[model samples]
Target: MSTTSDPAALSQETEQRPGAKTRVGGLNQHQMQEEDDIETVDYKMVTFSLAGKDYGIDILKIKEIAKFSSFTYVPNAPPFVSGVYNLRGDIISIIDLRVMFNLPAERKPEGSAEDGLILRLDELMIGVVVDSIDKVVGIVSSRIQPPHPIFGDVNIQYISGVVEKDGRLYIILDVDRIFAKGKSTTEEAESLSAVVAPETSAASDNIDELKQQTIPGLDGQSSGKNEEELDLEFIREGLGTFRGFYPDGIADSWLHRRYSEWRAERKKQGLDVQLTGEDDADNFMRTFFSPYSNRFLGEDYVEAVKAVLPEEVSKNISVWNPGCGKGYETYSLATVLRMRYPGHILKIWAGDNDLLSISTAPNLVFGADAVPTLYEPYLVEAKNGYSFSSEIKDAILFEYHDVTHTSTVPDIDIIVARDLMSFLHPKQQASVFNEFSQKTSTGALLIVGQNEHVPESQDWQHVGTSVVNAYRRL
Candidate 1:
């Protein structure tokens, strides 16, 4: 698809000249005045195409129309959220209009000048990827009508008004109504956008700085906490659910203050103020269980994991991958080790406490989205999605084991524990660390979660790749 002129360019073209006739969105000066006279209210809308259908969003909602560029993928985001992109200096979340509207995904051929529109929804900037840019139109209030009952699959509420311009219907979207109910938050939309920036020579040293960033999850964590107000009732209800999994002291302090502010801000925006028990439960599970194995290394932390791997290892390497969610980390390490020691006999003991996940781990299948270049060699075309090669799969011993109480995992050369530390109580974490210290021999590599701050009291030496939190048993 060819991208038509953007709103800015279109406006420049339509500006009246001393001797030139002006045209606004294909209308001559006469038609523009006629449109202005028909209704006291007129709207400037930027129209775009999604799956062959033309739709319009209020021009005021758009920050700018951005060219198609590479974006960073966010795992476990809502289906419509394509990813995030850095625009100029600000990061903006890009939402695919095709996916959001339940239309077919549009893929433009290579080297296209433009492929999406960046919108400023409320306080956040979001990119809405479209098939092509259509012209900017001035719609008269008198000509705008309610959506027909037979409108296409898009949710009717998203359509503010419909108009037949030159026998083609243009669905005018209500910006506030469509996004007001979105799971997207002002903070999360901003944070994801903020992750990627143009690195400069002056800032190269600062690039490796370890910063604690929040992962997008329950209670608007993707979006930062809103602090303008506090809702005590909302706080009380959330704390009730939180107390079941975590200590009351935790709920009383940082967690309490965090949720209270978020709930109040969400309430003020007329967003859902109450989280279902399942919402809280899922966050707890991801925090403790490390269910997102594919995502663990997608951040800047992956370099840290790669940096700590041994250049040359024994012909026989025994590895323990705890919190091995769906076997991604287990298989990932096996793939790397196999490449490093192509002739070695690799024995990986991977386990998780979740029975359902452990059962699924052996299959070694993952969604097509997980097939990044690093993971592609081991992943083969599988029935539903993708699976690992037999060579990569057969080396792992998948089991159900709770690491918190496990005492014996002997002769381990390396232990990869990602996202496991942050979930445990401080006492439990200390206990697990102590157990790890006793079970592994000297010089054993122990890798912890990226954001986790392991106790300094433990007698362990920090290995390189500080972002990934790797250590050597001293």
Candidate 2:
């Protein structure tokens, strides 16, 4: 049978088959069942255009849709391999689908980004560059007919199936088959290798020169000031590139110390010292965060924080907690502050750049077992779990706000920005510190990360013990 763009024509053709009912008003049980099966949509696909033809991939395979450009070039890669791209923190390989299928691709202007889909294939995340991304289309899985050689421009083996919807014929692609390993053909195997090879090879190859320059002690004596000041510079860049973490100002000392530890550990394991990927970058900075980060504060941590609180403050205590992820740290701080100053009117402006985290912070619930005993006084039992009582919850406000941008928060008595400054660039860190200085008054308390130190200034005095890295605004 010939393929047609009209779904109605295809339906009529199916009805004309042997034993199919041709009645208009009166339909048989078999015809009614067939119609019901066709109407039931069980599969969804993210549709896109390839060389002016409609195509689709299973929505379950897609991680996200993005439009990005300027991927880092990999040497000696396959012709179809578009250079690798930094997807947030992870380094993912990019493939040009048009080039892979030998289809005519539209020439884009210089530095223009192409539309792509990030696919989560097993443990790997790969981005495929396509002509244009269309809307998601849902259709009955039963309606998808077997793919024929005449239906698609690419190889019939790569096409999973074909389905007609809204006068359009969509060729469904089998991504697993296309990118699978150990293909029968030599050419196909090589192509598959090109996709997975970057996970081990490309990252190391890209930073080989930096690795060579790095010495055991990380002293910059080799190049006589011509090279990087320290071997940690490369790690710093990788952190910024892969994890958006910058080790400047308050984090500089920790970065240096962590480099020594990282190098020693890698040597003990007989592994390369350089941070080759996002996983390595994360491992390198694992110990840099404060205790109980992104979780409820424990008894020890709550006591350590309370010890740093000033003896005297105004009746109306205003606090600014930036990077308050999911309001865990915020709720923990609220409980601590309530214990510290029970009579004062507590107001906390908790802000985070993550929209999902901030949006759900107000209604966050925790299991009875998960919540610490320190928060029992302020806890309210819910149907599913326990949430903060009105006395604790009503005192804080969560907003989806970027810390780098201008905020309308009032003058603060305490600023809880633990491990937040290190993630920003040097210029951004300076700007934020300047804002902190302006927003806070004298004798106000400031809490930072364990490894981080506030930029040494006469205006701020170190008041924290070894357990807490805090300063009082002078």
Candidate 3:
């Protein structure tokens, strides 16, 4: 690279023959040595102290750090249930940090668990009481090595990896593993009606009391079950019917209503715990979705959905509905489009991966009252503000296509995926989105969930709130 002719320079050049290793070696040996010594990703093990003792939890696991608030202590609950607090809007549980660390108990006069740091974890929240949380230091993640298997023998089941930093050690907590272990066990839960459900209000108060009086390493719980005590029989029974449809999967409303009523009757007679047959799975699915289906996404959501469309694209549009679960939106969109277009033809190619829906198709008609917000046609009729236009049915068509097999996909002017990606993992979602981008014409619109995204998805323009992201394919 140089036009130098000096002998010393030529010698230097020969010694530093340009390859990755040569260039690396050509650096000031001292600087290169420093570079080698410094680890970026696994820089330094993060070290902090809790309750005057060394404590370390992976930085990634910590969703947030917040000052504790008054919680509703669950009465007669398992020992580990610290309490419940309002987190944003979701009712999140808080775990006592002191109980977790095997440290000296959290001391307070009477009701003191209510005041501490809130440590949020993956699926659950723990309210660990610490004398204080020190600064979060960068510890080399690479340096974190699994401890000898012996660590498990000492209630260290939650310790995932241990990292050494600055001649100090940090303990990494596996919140997921801990949560899985914390669930209630079976036999005691089978007798749960006798053990009694803990009052949510009391759960809060006791958390404060426990915070004041808990012993360090209170591993031996005073309770009916550890988290494993879930009524597996009930769970197994509850999940059975989802494996099959009720009344031959006819998609009959009478069958749907009867299915729920019969299940309720069985549950009242304690027959709910009986797994019976695959027919029960239908009951579970209906029950689970009954609350969420037909729900309104709100005006803001509608705006977000609209924003995903091109501003200049003509009003009457063609939409491809992938995984058009029960055609709620397929029909809803059909309604609005028919209303908006008057005479312009609006074609919707609605498909779902589930063959059962296609086999037992309604072709028209949506169950009203459930998710009453999303299916506005029902709401309009109920409110006496509008009447159904028989022409709306002509705008929609439902079909079946497995997204895993992308060849069935058709070219469309727009794609409305709703909450479709939520069920798929990030990688799967990304793959599907990639497939979507390819099939879509440039400037084609794509609609996705508020909580989901198309990763490495910059090809689409960010034109709306993420709750319902709308994109224009580049």
The residue-by-residue lDDT of candidate 2 on 180-246, one tens digit each, is 7554467775754575455334434534655565553356455643233455677778899999998
RMSD to native, candidate 2: 23.8
Q: TM-score of every model?
A: 0.42, 0.53, 0.35
Q: Per-residue lDDT for 414 in model 1? A: 85
**TM-score ranking from best to worst?**
2, 1, 3
Q: On a 0 to 1 TM-score scale, where does candidate 3 land against the true structure?
A: 0.35
Q: Which residue pairs in model 2 clash with each other?
A: none
**Tens-digit lDDT track of model 3 for 108-153:** 5564534344444545566554455665667656677885443421
Q: What is the lDDT of residue 271 in candidate 2?
A: 89
Compare the candidates by TM-score and give the number of the best one: 2
Candidate number with greatest lDDT:
2
Question: Which digits, one per residue and each the tens of the lDDT, describe model 1 over residues 175-220?
Answer: 7766664464555445433532222221333323311122122246
Q: Is candidate 1 or candidate 3 better by TM-score?
A: 1
**Runs in model 2 lying further than 4 Å from the true structure:** 1-230
* Candidate 2 overall lDDT versus native: 0.83
